[model samples]
Target: MTCPRCDAATIAFSIPAALRAHLPDDRPGAALCTHCLTVTPLDDPPDDTPSFERVSDAFPANDEAAVAFACVLALLDSLVLYRAELDAVATYAETHGADVLRALERLDADDGVDAHFDVARRTRQLEQFI
Candidate 1:
């Protein structure tokens, strides 16, 4: 799978045990973006949806696809901040961080501002990485 925000390659598995209780059990979990630090629900396009098919590979690789994905991530981040869902952002970052996931996980295990601060800092860090 790929991140809905950054088009960065990722994997979507079952939601973590810690987070399951907070999410909808009926829906399967989606991948979290390591770059944009956003979590998105899986959204599969129809087989006949040619407009969504931009590559021959199992995952998208085209430049257009990358840009679109990144834009989506940015929009999603803005929405989350606007809604003041800091915990959601922290969870997403914790689930997907390349090296800091563990630290984020620890911090998010309880109610605090550290995770939120880290999420904001890391998100800005990713803008440079991109």
Candidate 2:
């Protein structure tokens, strides 16, 4: 899976035993973005949906999809600092919509006046690796 924010490759990681009790039992693992250091909860893939088929369904031609794609690109350019491909952002926005994109923007925002400390910390780690 890719990082929802940066479209970077993600590594599957098991939730620590201590934290498992606080989460839903159905959550099997989490994915950590290599580039952005964002952690995402993961669930089992649905049985009926083939992954390849889902990939093919990502791009649906419609006005709403076009708007979402444009909005996501604007958000990435103005608000987000992480590197992301245009096609990947379009695909994600098409599938998830504007609300999810807004949430990601809020999570990654690092404005000097109202900094997000956790996001800044994670971003620092990414910078060090680069």
Per-residue lDDT of model 1, residues 38-104, tens digit only: 5555444222212212221221233333223322232333443323333443334334432233333
Q: For residues 43-111, what per-residue lDDT tens digits would candidate 2 score against the true structure?
A: 743332222112122222343443333223232322334333333444444464433333334445523
lDDT of 2 at 47: 30
Per-candidate alpha-carbon RMSD to the true structure? 13.4, 14.8
In Å, residue 40's CA in model 1 sits off its true spot by: 1.6
Residue pairs with clashing backbones, model 2: none
